[model samples]
Target chain A: MTLTDESPPMVNQAPSVPATQTVTLTVNGTAVELQLAPWTSLLDALREYMQLTGTKKGCDHGQCGACTVLVNGKRINSCLTLAIMQEGNSITTIEGLAQPEGLLPIQQAFIDHDAFQCGYCTPGQICSAVGLMNEGHAKTTDDIRELMSGNICRCGAYTNIVDAIQAVMHPQPDKL
Target chain B: MINFDYTRADGVTSAVRDRASELTAKFIAGGTNLIDLMKENVERPTRLIDINRLPLATITETEGGGLRLGALMTNADTAYDKQVSKRYPLLSQAILAGASAQLRNMATDGGNLMQRTRCYYFYDVATPCNKREPGSGCSAINGFNRIHAILGTEAGTPDRSIHCIATHPSDMCVALAALEAVVRVTGPDGDRTIPFAEFHRLPGNTPHIDNTLKDDELITAIDLPANGFSKNYAYLKLRDRTSYAFALVSVAAALEMEDGRITDARIALGG
Candidate 1:
């Protein structure tokens, strides 16, 4: 279960030289092109190259979900994936979570439910929640908690986060 | 990070040839681990051959009523695949039990098998880790070893002293070992197959060498035998937390029972 990325990066004293790659991504509804180093992760590409800092970089090692983004309709750790590797993939960050007209239901739900505090991890949590709802895996509150374990909120807003997600999962929960 | 050349592989044959022929050339599939290592200055690859466009991401059936998992198949897709869920449920359960949804979506099957140990000393360059540096003394030996491996261990001289007891940190590979899968590879010498159980070598005198994959070899696919451990299979993951954490120790067990008696069983442990 050692739930690390495919490979845990070991320490090294090897010599390294910078190399760059051009990537074309349809981000949030817009197509963005950037030239970045092969080692530049998707998190960095979005945050630095594209100037979309909504995606936070918590661990930069895939341990934290603060850099979560939707790539082709599925959530993934942006920090663990290289920018060049994601070329041609449509990426959706927290800033793009809303519609052209207004905020997304999940975004509004977070505010309505007060699902965050300090709000540093809010972007990742919101993006992850959108992906979680689309995957349609979480059925119960506990299931939501387990499935959303990747996104950590230091504010201890677990109950409210679950409530917000549950409201979207089963809208009738409020009516009941 | 060191400057390197990047080439998108046109096909499987060319990908293997390019990687095998060139030194310090690695096939970048998901980039989940490769990029991470690059940032830590661990793996200094001079050329990153992109193989994501290759047609090696499919999950199909083999001719012998078995399943063929493509090397580029992401962990999430394989875990949620209808066939994997029905046939090799142990693998599905094991994968789901490991990384989170975001990581699973990006981690590929080939990368999963190629995972390195999570030993703290191995990841901290300031420390002396024989795995990272062959001659570097192992700090974990005298340091904290709560997560050290308890199974298969050996000691060697300081120059090659491989007394590193770091355990494999892959839940998927643990299931693969128990299920007896075959790793298909294409190398400079052409194609070859390796038994799953023998994929990961025990931490012997060479703790640095994680698996049997050669420098130039490229993993093409993983062939899983016909549904053998479907029912009565359980993936038990134990760690500091209930989820989003590596297993301190985990078990993948598939049992076959007749009436009230046990007929056959396969179990593998992971940490």
Candidate 2:
């Protein structure tokens, strides 16, 4: 009648491994846990740890927009933000812009219009463009130029980049 | 890059007060300017105190009818805030005009105010710069002097001297200067306010010291005065490129005219 032998054995485990300063952040709609150094920039964390190398690191000085990303739906220079500073924040990198199966509408538009050349700055350009679309301050091409000015394309494909962005908002009948 | 100790402080008090006695400490908000400087060895703090998590990210209405901008509020937030857009249009416009959307989103008001000048000599360790090292001699005086200041320089002084002229870096602060903004600082003693004009110091005799802030002091907030001029202000920046480039010369103006005669005009220039 005694169930002592059937009961599971309780193992006294060694002290649980000290929990790392795990940052729980939502990246591209999926929650992720990352242990990062306090001084590791969000750009370095994304590129080095998460392997999201799409976000380039041209200047790493905040002078170049090659590392632009959306934190909580707002475009920010990832190089300027520390990873620990974004512990509970929502992050969206260039890799997150597209749908599961195919490219997002903006990516498609960039492709159709040949918005990039050499493609070094494409990820930042696309991410910045997405942010620009939601920004209320940009009204015209001039405004777009001013707003998009931060993301530098050494290829000098700005005219096409602007064209690609405009093509999405005002679809051309001829192109369609 | 050299490795250093990193500490994250929960609040302003701990960040400034609990500094290691033997080590130099820096309070980093937005790494926009600091990181670059660190990499270049311009700022070699033995310990970095991360203050980004502090509860200082609000743009509120002051009791005296002005705006109180929290130190931790990002530049983009202040620029896009509805109240800031409507009331201090100059500030909003200036903020938008300086950096790109991405940089602005990461840059905080406190860090923006503390940004160093874009002086080439200052950034180049090989070059002589009094601001970088006192008595190093100025290279810009004999070298590339095109971007150097002309308005504030004194006669007979070294052309590259920090005194009389060193470019005031912030587009936001330039607007604040014209709008007569007040900077609120929280020190070991308590909270205090300094006028915008007095907040930044001209190099004069000591080009090494930039602002009036003490080592233990932290800028808590910036309060913009409520005045008729603020409602009608505007900002114009002239830069080399259409985008991300720094200003060659910029102007922030708030003018009130009655019958075509200037009733009041507030102007702050940046070069």
Candidate 3:
């Protein structure tokens, strides 16, 4: 392994493919075990295998937060992380955002404030908003907008989305 | 994405040894950049040595009155960390200005330094890119290169043969350059420290060589010196949109002001 400038790199030396991989996760309060390819992304695993179709896959890249999910309480792009990498962790998707009895506060706020038009990016928006509020960063309306910029609302429903989030963060006297 | 063998590294030693043993073996933490490029087929690793489980996610105060950030610390966590926000607000601001809330949550500290250029030619396999393929000609030199480099490329002479002109699209690295951060890496031989400026190389004749790090080296931490940059500093990023857009050009400036006497300054630019 001489690293001199003269030697050509040994990148294409071998055909390195692995067998099927397995990963277990506490997804949406359920201990779900999945077998998948090593290259399978968390987004694909959630939507395709686990059938958690609520987490939409828009860009299939990290650019759009359509596949945003909370991994161990932190919001991350599910498309960016490999499914096998998240072995000993918990995953919370938009489908799991709702409580057993009823809708979560953020979900209720989105409904009350009319936060969706076509409702395509709503799941990602709600999930990311939940994580954002848990992060405890956004204070004012501008803060909410700035922090929520990751979840892109393609239908131009950003104004109502901000209203929905702001209402939850600082509830009105009677609205509460 | 191509199929690849995967192994979770036991520790730093094993990680370095595995990477040193195979040239195509890659250390994956956060998997934000590596997996993205793999999806695009821009980079194909034979084996991925997952380093996420490594105990490298602490942000501790160094004895030298500065912060030593763990390599695996996410950009969002580092930006909002109390120590980073208070002592090195410039770094926090820069990280915040680069990626969105979700991307920052996924992108790691060392991964930010390792992310490749957003050059279209490099991403597109059909085009001829010297950076992507060593002997191939650069298409961006003759084609649409509005978002390319302006400073390091032969200073406005499009007449000469341009090797490669793609710019590093990192806002965190820009701030790291201004802060004069030191990158701590552990390789097969031993541990070595690389200065931030020398870490990223200009796309000169050898446009393929992205950075100065050895292929076997694994970045463990970033050490910041005694920060005289807490008071007067700014990270201004000019971009297409307000958020979720790569910067067209960005500037990170830190000034040391003792009673408004204009003592010292550090400035770095990026795109």
Candidate 4:
């Protein structure tokens, strides 16, 4: 649900603007605190409040996967969940994927296969791929395609995206 | 969505008490559908009772050799659970065939049953929808009605007293209907159980009421029968897209075969 902290009991009718509550969220690797209204979504908290623009907002209604992020290592539409409800949970965004040394395997693989053309849905695609691997469900190419159907590339980059994810999922041995 | 006060319910008793006290306060579990409705102005709850922290997310075996699915259990977990997939594969397949991986991860079992109809007129406040506002008028009755209900309507009657074309948009309920599961709910008054077949009501005169659930009642769990249709079963969903789309027409069939002969069968259809 959209995030909103509860206020003290009102003796009279509730006011138009409810009181903003303090919500602590563990984003990427840091614990950031913010005063958010009850209607603030986690996606809005990340992009607007925390300045983590790496996570894009495609369809805020959960129809598109562009707003996806890992909540406790499981991918979910951040736009649908309220920031206040995720207090005790650990959230991972696209910015947290790569190590300090280099890019993540899926991120690098995307570049190698030219997985994205517009790059609008790339962050969500990469995060979803990481979640898919953790889930350990995808086996065949069809499985990957089916599981990754939520992330849509309007530029028609399905073939390359599938290739990139498959390459990361099943890496080939280097030749001598 | 407008600003609403939120409270995290500690237990089922407190949750029910809170709901019973307030008429406009809604319980927020997954918020997958509730938030969408709130954004569209279809639902305007002044206060929201967050029940995500409730201790009802477990799946336990019943004394009758059945399975009891906790109301707060995520659809993804229930579908992928070893006991569920091994014993009730039809349910697992049906849950997987409905929504995307992300939605299944957030949507809870109880919330899945509470999904509103996807009828365009119902969501649009401008249109005249009887389900939205009774006696206003049914927009789908005469307007573009491709996704409306085919049955449970009497268009040719002399005087149309009972008429609503909206349909409940859920794929999991179809399998539950075929399996004859039981819905356990707790209300301010007490606890009760409702049969799956009698849970959802047709769009009769009162189309606004979707199910038989009381205003203050909370679904605690869903009890599955011993016969889970683990074998000799099939779930087919015909949708516009192969994945991440609602079903146009779906069917769930389970058969009991004795020595290659069909002894019994259960079948249910959904749209």
Model 4 lDDT tens row, B81-129: 9999999999999999977888888999999998888888989989888
lDDT of 1 by residue, A11-38 (tens): 2436665645567878897887787777
Per-model TM-score on C-alpha atoms: 0.92, 0.88, 0.94, 0.94
TM-score of candidate 1 against the unseen true structure = 0.92
lDDT of 3 by residue, B164-221 (tens): 8888889999999999999999999999999999999766667788898999999999
Q: What are the runs in model 4 whose C-alpha is more than 4 Å off? A: A1-15, A172-176, B154-162
Using DockQ as the measure, which candidate wins? 3
Q: Native-vs-model 4 lDDT?
A: 0.86
Q: What C-alpha lDDT does candidate 2 achieve relative to the native structure? A: 0.79
lDDT of 3 by residue, A1-176 (tens): 11124222635545555677568878987988888878888899999998899999998877778899998878889999989888888899988877788998889999999999988899999989888887888878888888888888878889999988887878642222
The lDDT values for all models are: 0.82, 0.79, 0.86, 0.86
DockQ of 2: 0.21
Model 4 chain B poorest 10 in a row by lDDT: B155-164
Best by TM-score: 3
- Candidate 2 ranges with C-alpha deviation above 4 Å: A1-26, A31-36, A171-176, B19-23, B154-165, B228-232
- Separately for all candidates shown, the number of backbone clashes (residues 3 or more apart, or on different chains) is 10, 1, 0, 4
Between candidates 2 and 3, name the one with more favorable lDDT: 3
lDDT per residue (tens digit) for residues A1-176 in model 4: 11122221222444588788899999987998899998889999999999999999998888889998999989898988899989989999999989898898889999999999999999999999888887888889999988888788899889999998889888741210
Which digits, one per residue and each the tens of the lDDT, describe model 2 over residues B190-235?
Answer: 8898999998877765676788987778899999887727546778
Model 2 chain A lDDT-worst window of ten: A1-10
